[model samples]
Target chain A: AQSVSQHNHHVILSEAASLELGCNYSYGGTVNLFWYVQYPGQHLQLLLKYFSGDPLVKGIKGFEAEFIKSKFSFNLRKPSVQWSDTAEYFCAVNAYDYKLSFGAGTTVTVRA
Target chain B: DVKVTQSSRYLVKRTGEKVFLECVQDMDHENMFWYRQDPGLGLRLIYFSYDVKMKEKGDIPEGYSVSREKKERFSLILESASTNQTSMYLCASSSRTGPNSPLHFGNGTRLTVT
Candidate 1:
């Protein structure tokens, strides 16, 4: 089974700081990459996804991810983050099948 | 927007008791999934159903089973609950758009087995 790896376990930053979370996957075959976010007391929601065409995908809340096939990475980044963007971020990848493998999530704590 | 609802927010059960986690999706999605989420372990798929009465075991299907008798509802059953099985159970659904389609998740059910 394929696995995903998120290097950062926890991140803490002040408001207006730029945020970047690293994500890497194991499988080399055709894959779909995604980033999902879960706010406190809320369910997981899609942040962004990458299937084909463009390697740079823009998602909600001014979040974006770049899928670099050679590096086997799809990293999530934001120019400036708000306290509201504080949430648990997950990086997921699925191979030809419908089963998605998720990384150990990263908890982003933004201070006011 | 897609809405998925889990029947229970929290549950506690004994070791030898049978446990059921129910999930219902309002969207007419063809696929439904059951997953367990733990800190640092991420989300692990337990089971998924493609259509009515069709089920498939996922990466961690041990000690767990699922049923999909209807299109909207999917049920996960544990024959004898164990302490290790205690975790946040998540239910998600997606249309048959493709494998790339994002899954719509429901508020999870936190289960504890004593």
Candidate 2:
């Protein structure tokens, strides 16, 4: 079974601080990676996705993720984060089928 | 925009009661998924349907069953609700366009079993 692991459980940072959340998946075959974010009361929305070609994929709201096949990692990054970036971030992987395996998720709190 | 609509935003049920969480999609997507989200568990897939009348169990489908009579709707059912089943249930739909297609999610149904 394929599983996703997110190293950071919770992160607290001041506004304008850089953010990087580590994500690793346990799949060796062709995989699709995604970063989804959930606001306080909003549904989960796609922040970015990596299907093929480019390893560095840019997403909405200044979010980006790099898919490193060698490392089996697709980490989410942002040069600077705002208070609005405070949300729960999830890393998901699809290896064989339409089913997506998600990591435990990282709670990000950006303070102003 | 693709829309996945869950019927309820909040639900409270007693133990041993049968509970149903409804989800409908407007994008004519061929795939619909049911997931339960906890504080640290992220989203665990409970069940998924690829087409009408075709359902498959996901990683954690022990206490749940699903119904997909129509292509646009998928339903998750808890035969006997328990306290452990209390969590935020999310419904998502995605087209079978390709592997890169992201899921469109409903706002979610927060269920509490007493």
* lDDT by residue (tens digit), candidate 1, B1-114: 899999999999999899999999999999999999999988999999999999999999999999999999999999999999999999999988889999999999999999
For model 1, the DockQ equals 0.85
User: What is the C-alpha local distance difference test score of candidate 2?
Assistant: 0.96
DockQ of candidates 1 onward, in order?
0.85, 0.85
TM-score of chain A, all candidates: 0.99, 0.98
Q: Model 2 segments beyond 4 Å from truth?
A: none
For model 2 chain A, the run of ten residues with the poorest summed lDDT: A93-102
lDDT of 1 at A76: 100
* Whole-model lDDT values for every prediction: 0.96, 0.96
Compared to the true structure, candidate 1 yields what TM-score? 0.99
lDDT of 1 by residue, A33-101 (tens): 999999999999999999999899999999999999999999999999999999999999998878888
**What's the residue-level lDDT of A40 in candidate 2?**
95
- Model 2's CAPRI class is high
Count of clashing residue pairs in every prediction: 0, 0
